[model samples]
Target: MKVRVLVSLKPGVLDPQGRAVHHALEGLGFAGVQDVRIGRTIELDLADDTNDEAIDRMCRQLLANLVIEDYSFERLGDGESA
Candidate 1:
């Protein structure tokens, strides 16, 4: 089974890295760039028998910092759904 986890900061949080990237993009002549937010994606290839609960635990325990970010996951395979 393949899992893709998207981890992003909560809406009210400040993302300095994203801001820096946005500035750099403008400096490089990219036009009309309004804003940028940085986040992380984690791809995991797990056993076919892995369950949703375990995945959720992984996200809570290590994959995301619950205090500052929100995370979502998708199972990526023809026979799977999240």
Candidate 2:
């Protein structure tokens, strides 16, 4: 099974990298941009029998920093609807 985990900074957390990209966009004459934020993705290959509870545990324990970040995930299977 293919699992994709997305991790992102919670609202109100300052992101220097995101800010830099926003500034660069403005410098390039891309106007009307208000703000920007960035996040990360982690892909995992797991046994087909992996259950949702275990996957959720993995995300809480290791995939994301719960104190400052939020995360979400999904399982992707070939020709299978999500």
- Candidate 1 lDDT tens digits, 19-71: 99999999999999999999999989889999999999999999999999999
TM-score (C-alpha, index-matched) for candidate 2? 0.88
Highest lDDT among the candidates is held by which one? 1
lDDT per residue as tens, model 2, 1-81? 888889999999999999999999999999998999999999888899999999999989999999999999999878664
lDDT of each: 0.94, 0.91
Candidate 1: deviation at residue 29, Å?
A: 1.3
Error of model 2, residue 71, in angstroms: 0.1
